[model samples]
Target chain A: MSSQAPETTQIHNIGYRSYDGPRLGRAYARRALFSQSLRGAYGLGRSAKSKVLPMLLFAVMCAPALIIVAISVYTKADKLFMEYTQYAVYLQLVIAVFLASQAPQSVSRDLRFRTVPLYFSRPIERVDYVLAKYGAMASALFVLTATPLVIMWIGSMLAKMDFAEQAKLFGQGLVSVAVLSVLFAGVGLVMAALTPRRGFGVAAVIAVLTISYGAVTTLQGISYTTENTGSIIWLGLFSPLTLVIGLQNAFLGAPASFPGEMQVGAGTGAVYLLVVLGLVAACYGILMRRYRKVGL
Target chain B: MIATESLSKRFPRVTALDRLSLDIGPGVTGLVGANGAGKSTMIKILLGLSPATEGSAQVLGLDVRTHGPEIRERVGYMPEHDCLPPDVSATEFVVHMARMSGLPATAARERTADTLRHVGLYEERYRPIGGYSTGMKQRVKLAQALVHDPKLVLLDEPTNGLDPVGRDEMLGLIRRVWTDFGISVLVTSHLLGELERTCDHVVVIDGGRLLRSSSTSDFTRTTTTLAVEVTDSDAHPDGAASLRAALAAAGVTIHAGVEDGLPGAGHVLLLEAPGEETYDLVRDTVAGLGLGLVRMEQRRHHIAEVFKATDQEEVPAR
Candidate 1:
């Protein structure tokens, strides 16, 4: 067609609605994030295969409590081999493996896929993001460690123990488990946030745990042979696992589970708690700073 | 709506956004730039996800430096690269994001459903995102951004990995995000043609600087040249040559289009139409010469031509 003029313009009305709903502020955003990340740590709302690893690790961590209970019931024994607070020390390797395996599932996946931008672009601050992550991981570890502690208490009750003493022990065990889980959660999340790859994060977390445990044990062993109690207490303060046991021994009135005569006193246990808290604070700082520039 | 004054972003090695000053109103605006032209950097700074090295900006009347949380609450952002986690279902992910945006439990699910349906991913939305196609993943990203119904959305390279048909649908959807939802959209793309069809206004940037910012109509103005195509016939198989001669005899000027060695100028003619009278004259001349007029329309400047013309003119944005 030949035309000197162009086509006419017509406007179409699609009736696009404007949203006038109520939008809650930053507090709601942080609460929702904390809940979501808590689910993410346990692989909740994710695929079946994703759920498998966390669930299996959880079951493995609970095995010793179930076994000790069964043995106590069968033998009709009192005062079982595993103390509630000492459980963490007895299964430190398993707990370390669980933390190494599960921590990356919570934080590193966001970094690996560069989804940190999505999280940071919301109403929440960088500090809020790490806090939510810390809360979620700590909650997951509490569930893992406390379930076994409860099971051991049930076994003690079934074995005709003094109900009063068992209840007291359970209370102390809960506190110890809570504190130790905080330590593990803080360290695990920090290591996971430092690297994007899941395998590298897992290896780094396990290496931190294992290497420190080995170094502290060797030093404490040498100190014990030389009858150097001061040196043993000093070296015990360095490893998180040792400090965890030290805190349990000093506060819960539980006997020392460490090798030889390296019994941690109440003063040393108080120092351990302070130092563990410092480590947790340091981890939180690293996480907040890491995310501040990650989105850019 | 977004406004920036002397905004700049600098890294150690390169400057991303340099003295960018933009005033965008509520509508669908397209930000066009090449790779590494600071498109992503501009979006980040506007969202307050990153700080500007110098100057300041505002989104929805909120300061970028002080009100990042408030601005982010009202503005949705879809990043350029793939950032979806692989293990979660699309519904789960979008609902989670909606909740993060402050929608309650039931409201979050309802909005997630509506947004997923609008993006055209129904049955597949239940599957893990790891198994989704690139188009599906892109749609999921869009769904998450829209599930909470923000006042404005910033979509960066929404059609990066789609086929032609998928690109067309995504472009149409982006246009409707404004038309149907009454939301302002700041969508970016490297391809100018993609924006030409959807955007009401376009801002072109090159090398971290503003090259042009104008309404779509002004950017593509109708020029004086008109294209005339003719069909060969038994009376005059060489219709173009005959038409040119007859028009020249009739006091009409024709420019040399594509050369054809034989003065016939192939099947098309580029006529310089000084006025409406020229079009009628050319039409009457073709009919008088016993030739069929295939098409005759005024040519308009394409968006790509702006870049080529700018290269020659070397004019910066005013």
Candidate 2:
């Protein structure tokens, strides 16, 4: 054997201390994920490029209300040109665009980059991830639906309308916003979660909203010509927007606005509410199942 | 710090992990294997991100099936692939991760800043991660894993795309993760040579089966062949030939052409040195023959030699 001596080395101390601090468990995890996802839905914590679409779409939702308010205040008109409850329906395309663009911002990007592994490796459960995404999407839609109503309220004050009538309309419009937010948010997030590709997710959400509207209008046209009343009540169930409007009309004791819903009597508010709950539950179930297998 | 029992995972047509069991203590351990060796699968099971098809596992004494949330709260994971979202800055992403691990809001920001600096990311942490280089992206991924100060970190192929210099830097940082912070680490790599210098122990596997698990020194045992060279001089002409003859006469087998044409001898002689006495016998035999011993040393095995140990028999995982 060759004669060689063993060498010894000393360890140096470069300080990196252990953390013995408090680590709150599931409740904190839930709140943190929920808040971050809510901000992400509006592109708050990301680059400027990501903020462009949501900001533009939000502006588009407010433009018509602002212009009508300006004309009334300048001319001193006595009545509003547009009702707050009907604005989202008249500009359903813009609302659809907002949902299509923003839903994937929270769900598809995480899937595309495989960032779910980072999320699932934390203290949160898989269902908690799904719930956070749902809450964020619903809140964003609620903001979009409610902002125009608030603008109309401010315009009513500027126009010097009767305060009691305006307050009643505002409360009625908010009930519509609350119901529609849950309905549209459920549909948008589930489609994005299932597709998980941005372009296809966009197409799928838009298609779900528009295609259902088309089918409802066609069935309503057929019923209008035939004068068939029973088929008209059932056809209102196909389109989510029309279905929500029917609930608003039924509960507020207002005249029906859409063509298809005028034939259905105003006594079916309980059935409409049940269908709304069922739709929300179904979408929630699918989203939760999608995430359970995502991190694996 | 980690334990598994009869763990098996199967896809529709393939079994990823087959009855693999391992018990690892607190230190830096390397899981050595080739591609498709079920290394990622085993790590996911340990973290409780994925359930095993059968059997049981635990991390830091929490059962994988019943206590996944608690286990995940304490263990950090650096996944093998590119898993970072491209639109957010590193600071934003790491702070979110820290908060997700149950740190309070102010502490999350503080820990994120400290972790980014520790991972060698300074001003660049403010830029979107989509514009960063592969090495920079890797550092961000590594930083998020450590932001929570977990008890153990399971890193899957941390040096997959790094250059030689970047690889060495990452390996040094991993070693320091254990030494400076006293956290346990289980790192995986398909390449075996790199782990020899970094890991205190190594567990080798193939085709979803455990082949061997032992300390790095034990797996790299001293081999039986001794390489001997003698100086050819005036006092002893043909020194290599005389030593070969003398060692053979002293009841040692000599392979006459060890590196047959080395410049110091006409040929280097190889001798069987299985015990300490055999080394002494070689020195005495060469001295008696009046030949100069140039060099004589036992051959040390490489990590590649461990692959052949699988063919000998199945070794239960330790």
Candidate 3:
């Protein structure tokens, strides 16, 4: 490297200078909002205090996969102890907790602070705002649900399991996780958007997830004891968690893990699939309308 | 820079803006109206954030109806309410806003720094907005609007909560936005005097209708009134009364100044000077009354007088 003084010297004035550079259009603006919102979901660009909860929940989500891996290695098992598709079922609480804590952080802060008008006044449209927020929350949930499946797949590989069989199961587990992430994100974002207060948003999301699951499971249990097999299929459709599990069992040919080994038959699974799509679409409809009238 | 025709916005219960039409050109134009006089409503329609019920509008030659995103790309807006987030630093917020306006990441950062500095926020730009004073918060709001370097900026009650000195500084910055950067500004305020000094043109609307729209100089043109003040001494204990009597007896048309104490002067009297000889006539008349003359100056009309006069004209209609 030759060290020579530069011949050209220019002093930039410190006054207001016009910007004549290239400006990306609406698509780029929408993408920027998506990236900002995704980072915000994980509290990446926020203060240290805001980072603690989401990070801790993420760490807690990964712990069970690590322990399962250690148990398989120690036991010298021919096959892994847990099924990849069934992992989310055992850790539903962690997933629900993560959704409860992070969903409000994504949607509620803008409303509570009245910053929605700032976004609307720019090049981004109202529908763009809703889509960006929903996409970010879903991507955050996707990461939350997919990391453990990858870890378990890696563990099975280390445990000297059959590669072809493990790959097929892992692929199926990923599909199920993708579907679950979408459903959960829709539910959580709609709940958060309903209230401007962060605390209320968190509570509403948690209450919807846990209370619906509890009520559906209780109703299923009662109906099963009374030998009412017909209502068991309908009762499981009310909760989001049960609906996803049914979709997985019916469509992916996975074993039924519901209470009492209840089989999710072909017909019930079809209805579950329809309901899931319907619920997600309805959530979008509500979010679009909700953001339209707020902070104007 | 902005034009509207027969614009009307109606809610279920009340009409916010009714058959309002305006034509504004470049430079700093002030939209003067009281609260709920549809200033904010008009801004929303012009920005295309809310649809107008009846009429069409254009900003920077783009139709607000079909080209909302296009118009917003070239325009910046500072809302009236407190809209800054509390937890983020001003720099972070402004940078994000710049990105929202379609600037790339690097340009957004660079523009945010420059705009924050221009708004007089230095080291404090990195601090969280929750700890800032009202003046600092207002600056942050303004910096976000200017970061993208738009061709037009709409400011809504920028001096709503600022103290006297802060109000002056903010107004000076608004004036420079037009002078130094050549960005057209449409600032709204209820106070007429502040706009008299800051705006090149002023538009006054009342009850969702235009009251007056003219240049600031036209509103404050020189009048035929003379303001006279006399010294109150022991010899002439009531010098203002004696001077008023003398001017009236001499057939000079005199009007009363409030309490003989207008804002910056003492014991002043207002008389209509129809011709050139009214000055010499008043001098001789004050000397004959044995009162010392304090000040005798021609008075230029203030915008407040225009506002009051229109207000009186509307009283009978109401």
| lDDT winner between candidates 1 and 2 | 1
**Compared with the true structure, what per-residue lDDT tens digits does model 3 show for residues B1-318?**
999999999989889888888899999999998889999989988888888999888999888988999888889999888998899999999999999999999999999988988889999888899999999999999988888999999999999899999999999999999999889999999999899999999999987889999999999988898888887767678888788887888899988654333563547888899888999999998888778888888888789999999999999998
Judged by TM-score relative to the true structure, which candidate is superior, 1 or 3? Answer: 3
Q: Which of 1 and 2 is the better model by DockQ?
A: 2
Could you tell me which residue pairs clash in candidate 1?
A16-B180
Q: Using lDDT as the measure, what is the rank order of every candidate, best first?
A: 3, 1, 2
Between candidates 1 and 3, name the one with more favorable lDDT: 3
How many Å off is the CA of A54 in candidate 3?
A: 1.0
Over B1-318, each residue of candidate 1 has an lDDT whose tens digit, in order, gives 999998899899999988999999998999998899889999989898788999899999999999999998889999989889987789988988887877887888888888888888999898889999998999999988888889899999999999999999999999989988778999999999998899999998877888889988877889899888787789887988888898889887788865357444477888889899999999898888888998898889888888678756665543
- Measured over all alpha carbons after superposition, the RMSD of each candidate to the real structure, in angstroms, is 6.5, 6.5, 3.5
On residues B1-318, what C-alpha lDDT tens digit does candidate 2 reach at each position? 999998999999989999999999999999987899899889888888788999889899999988988998899989888998887889999999998999898888988888888888999999989999999999999988999899999999999999999999999999988987788999999888888888999998777888889998886778798988777768768888777767777789776555545565454777788788999998888787777777888877777676666655554543
lDDT of 3 by residue, A1-296 (tens): 44686778888776779999987878889999999988887889999998898888889888899999889978978777888778888888888888988888888989988999999889999999999999998999989889998988899899988899989999999999999999999999999999889999989999999999999989988988988867887888999998988899898757887767788989989899999999999999999999978836
Q: Given candidate 2, what's the lDDT at residue B195? A: 88
Report, for every candidate in turn, its global Cα lDDT versus the true structure: 0.86, 0.85, 0.89
How do the residues A14-60 of candidate 1 rate in per-residue lDDT, one tens digit apiece? 34334556777678888898888788767787767778878888888
Considering summed lDDT, which 10 consecutive residues are worst modelled in model 1 chain A?
A: A12-21
Indicate which candidate wins on DockQ: 3
DockQ of each: 0.53, 0.61, 0.72
> How well does model 1 score by local distance difference test?
0.86
For candidate 2, the per-residue lDDT at B87 reads 78
